[model samples]
Target: MNKFAALCLILCAAPANAHPHIFINAGLVFVVDADNRLTHVQVTWEYDELYSLLVTEDMGIDADYDGVLSEADTARLTGFDMQWIEGYNGDLVGTLAGQNLTLSAPTAPTATLTEGKIVTTHLRAVSGAPQINGTLSFLPYDGTYYTAYDVTLPVLVQGGNGCEVTVDTPDIKGALSMTKAEIGALPEDFDMEAAGLGDIGRRFATDVRVTCAAL
Candidate 1:
C-alpha cells in the first residue's frame, strides 16, 4: 500500500490508549520579511537514537556502526522524510487570528547524523505572507499519536523585529482525564473503528505561539 493508504489504516486502528512509538524533538524558526509579514517557517526534527539506528540500518548506511554518517550517507539521507504523502499535513498546524494558514510544500531539506541521532530540517513557505500583528500559533503532532513531538529545542523568530516566541505546554493531567472520560463513555459494544480517536495527540500537544509588537 502507498504511504497515504498505510497512514489511513494506522489512524483507523489506533486506540485512545495507544502510545507513541517514535519520539522527536522539534524546533521552528519563523521567518519574517522586512515589511513584517510572515513569510516562511523552518522546521527541525531530531529523531531519537532508536529510530536513528533503525533508519541507518534499513538504508544500509553507517558501515562502521559508529553512529556517524559519511558525506555520501548524509546526501542520501537528505530529503528522505520529505517524500510526504498527499493529505498529510506534515504533522504541522498553524493558525493566525483564528484562521488556518496555508503552508507550501517542504523545501531546502537537510539531514545529518549527530550524537547517534538523526537531525533534519526543511522550510515551509506561508502561502499568503500574512502580516504579523496578532498572535500566531503552531502545533506539531501526529493525529494517530504514533509519533510524538516535543518542542524541546529553540523556537526562534528570524528577521522580525520586536517579536516574542513562547512555548505553551498542554496540561497533561487534564488531557488524560478528558481522554479517560471519553473512553469510559463509550458503550461496551461500541465499535472502536468509529471512535474517532485519531486526534488524541492534539490534546497533549505543545503550543508554539508568536506575538509581534504592533507594526
Candidate 2:
C-alpha cells in the first residue's frame, strides 16, 4: 500500500484516546509580489525525534546508528517526505477571504537531518497569485488526527509590506470534549474504514492568518 494508505490504516485503527503517532513542528513563509499578491508559501516541518529515527532506520540511513548523516546519506534523504499520493493536499489548507485557494503541489523540496530529527521544507505556489488585501489564512493539520502539527516556529510574511501574521491556537479542552462525544456516539461495531470521521484534527489546528494593509 502507498504511504498515505498505510498512515490512514494505522491511525484509523487506533483508539480515539490514543495520541497522534507523528509529531511535527511546522512554519510558513508567505511570499508575496510587489502588488501584494501571494505567490507562494514556503513550508517547513521538523519531525519529532522518534519519527525521525524510524524513518532513518527504515531507509537504512545512518548505518552506524551515530545519529549523524554523511553527505551521501543527506543527499539520499532529500525530498524523502515530498512524495504525496494523489489528492493528498499535503495536509495544508489555505484560504483567502473565506474562499479556498488552490495550491500547487510541493516544489523546491529540501530535507536535512538536524539533531537526529528530519527537517524538511518545500514551496507551494498559489495557483492564481491572488492579491491579499483581505485575509489569507492557512491551517496545518492531518484530517485523520494521525499526525499532529504545531505551529511553534517562525511565521513570516515575506515581501509583503505592512502584512501582519498571526497564529491562533484552538481551544483544546472544548475540541477534545466534542470529539469524545462524537466518538462515543459511534456504534459499537462501526467500521472506521467504511465511514471515517471527517477532519477531526481541524478542531485542534492552529490558525495562521495574514492580513496586509492596503497601499
Candidate 3:
C-alpha cells in the first residue's frame, strides 16, 4: 500500500499487537514511605472475572453470582489457602462467615503526585461496599476452636497517573512461583480498570478517591 495507508495500518494494529487480552477491571499503586520500603496496597477486581476463576463460569464463592456465596462454597473454603495469588494481602478481615468483603478503613488519606511522569501500575481491590460475598480471612488459634477474622477493608488508597505495573514470569524451570508486582512503578498496560495476561489476581479500584477521612 501507499505510505499513508501503511501508517494507518500501523496505528490500527497498535492496541491489539501489544497486550494479549482485553482487560476489563485491573489497576496498580505503590506506597513508599520515607524509608523507600513498600507499604500497603489497595486492589479492586472485576466481579465477573473473579467469579469465573474462583467460582465457575459465574460460579465461585457465590456460585450463582447472587451477591452471596453458596453455603457449600463457604464451607469448603474454610482454612484453605489460595495459591497463585499475585497481589494477595496477608492481613485478612472478612472470612469464616460466608459473606462479601467489608473492609472498612477507619481512616483515609490525602494524595499528591510526586514526579511528573507516568507511574507504571498494577493494582485492584478484593472487597468493599456494594459487595456481598468473597473475601479472605486470618486464622488464629484460640487454644481450642480457631477463629478467622476478615480483613477485607477499604482503606484510603492513593496512586499516580501515567503509571503501569506488570508481571515478569521468568522461564526458569523448577517451581514456577508467581511473582507479580503492583508497586515500585506502573504496569505495562495499567489502565486501573483492566486486567492483562497472568494478572488474574489484579483488582482495579472503583470510585478511587484519596481524600482524608472526616474522622
Each prediction's total of clashing residue pairs, residues at least 3 apart in sequence or on different chains, is 0, 0, 46
- Candidate 1 structure, TM-score to reference: 0.86
Ordered by TM-score, highest first, the candidates read 2, 1, 3
lDDT of 1 by residue, 131-187 (tens): 887889999988766688989988999997789888998775676666666666666
RMSD in Å for model 3: 19.8
Q: Give candidate 2 regions above 4 Å deviation.
A: 1-18, 189-196
Better-scoring candidate (TM-score), 2 or 3: 2
1-215 per-residue lDDT for model 3 (tens digits)? 44223322332243323221222232324342332222434432222233234433322444444544355754544323223245434223223134434333322222111121111122323332221112222221111101111112233323332222322222311111221223213443344334332322222112222222111
**lDDT for each residue of candidate 2 in 100-174, tens digit (9 for 90 to 100):** 999999999888888888999999999989999788999999987778899998999889778899899988667
lDDT over C-alpha atoms for residue 212 of model 3: 20
Model 3 CA deviation exceeding 4 Å by range: 1-24, 34-36, 40-42, 47-54, 57-65, 70-82, 85-215
Which candidate gets the maximum lDDT versus the true structure? 2
CA lDDT, every model vs. true structure? 0.83, 0.84, 0.28
Using lDDT, rank the candidates from best to worst.
2, 1, 3
TM-score to native of every candidate shown: 0.86, 0.88, 0.24
